[model samples]
Target: MSLEGFLAASARGGAIPWSEELRAAREFGLSAREVEAAAFGAGLLPARYSRNAGTIGLAGQAVLHASCVAVAGCGGIGGHVIEQLARLGVGTIVAVDPDVFEESNLNRQILATVENLGLPKVEAAALRARAINPAVILRPLRARLDSRNAPSLLEGADVVADGLDTISARLELAGACARLGLPFVHAGVAGWYAQASTQAPGSSSLSDIYGHGTAPAERGVEAALGNPSFTPALAASLEAAEVCKLLLGLSGTLRGRLLHLDLLAMECAEFPI
Candidate 1:
């Protein structure tokens, strides 16, 4: 089949799995990426992402489809962030999480499931990404991230996401991103409130915004006020949007400011560091 023939076939199918798409493209002496581009041009990669084309354009969409994002943590915020990235056509996802799914995680963790109760969070994230976008390449690291291993664990990512549950871990992840000169999307949730920000290297670090002594008395206020299903979802959505903007080289990122959301009051406010 020629490129046109593959596009026509893709249109007729309305979607094609990655393997079949590659096989068909190879039969026509075309690269898989070229076939993917042809599919997009032919309007066969599913209209699901068509809405994004208007906002980000075909060029931006291509950028997203070729981008790689690393998510540190796979709990409530991280899981949702990773899911959104994959669904938005990020070509590769590097997810790091040492924990396993538990009953406590089902509330807001999109990758958590009853069947995966004992599975590693990174494994669950990988499975979720595969099920959502088979074409997405997911690299799961089932290990904790500290300053020592952060760089290697998060290597090669265009941007890094801070989805850690503890204040100290968040600080550590932010420091790693800064050292690597990578953009970081940081978010945290507690009860009905959540905050998000994009930290560009040399700008305001997470520590600069929250301060070194800002570590919560406890692991997080969520332990007391509780983390509802909605708070992390809202926060992670903002973080994902920031990552998308950064990946596409767009402006107006929350580089030196924090976006705070209060679901209880239904208000969103941004404040400078």
Candidate 2:
């Protein structure tokens, strides 16, 4: 079926009409039981969802229909960010990463399995995301994110999630989003230290905290020491949760503030932007 047809079917209580469902069952490789199960999934079927499913269901539906872009660095944080976004049902994802997997990635990178050792980070992440949700549309750009393509890639995105490492790149992306009137969530990880902030257009941004060119010495040291899955996992999950809240038009978004977490100190706090 066409992409529009698929989306239309997804809107009607998650079940396509009779002929489409039969065809999908036959040609798309989905089993009859799997089709039945999907039909009953809460976000797809209003009848199947309970009142409590409202939050997740509405969040999932909004994400399932919205288009989003993420500019990421190493697959550790980037991979986890994509995983959480896909599981939450974000429909369209554009992932930017130029790096390839290496032996050193096993400790934190989600796509860094031995089998995928030589693959491009974006490709590996796209593969994993598709495995989780076949219907998810992913545009994997295996290149560095710079000023030139940042705006184009992020254009029309309902929200932007940052898993980038470099301060320069982060500032450039944040500025680009600010110009485009997009909401952005910024996340950075180094060692057991991670920080995140959300910014709406015309609001405070990453540059506000990190400055235009000055990189934090502590953040550099943390990146040099490398990050553990434990930290990226925590940070990415929080970033994804905040993204979901923003997409669903929910209140209490982590806008205009920064949240800092230090695993060693077991301390987490929010500070003004």
Question: What C-alpha lDDT values do all the predictions have?
Answer: 0.81, 0.70
Colliding pairs, model 1 = none
TM-score of each: 0.87, 0.79
Compared to the true structure, candidate 2 yields what TM-score?
A: 0.79
Q: Best TM-score goes to which candidate?
A: 1
lDDT of 2 by residue, 138-161 (tens): 778888877688777665578888
Poorest stretch of ten by lDDT in candidate 2: 43-52
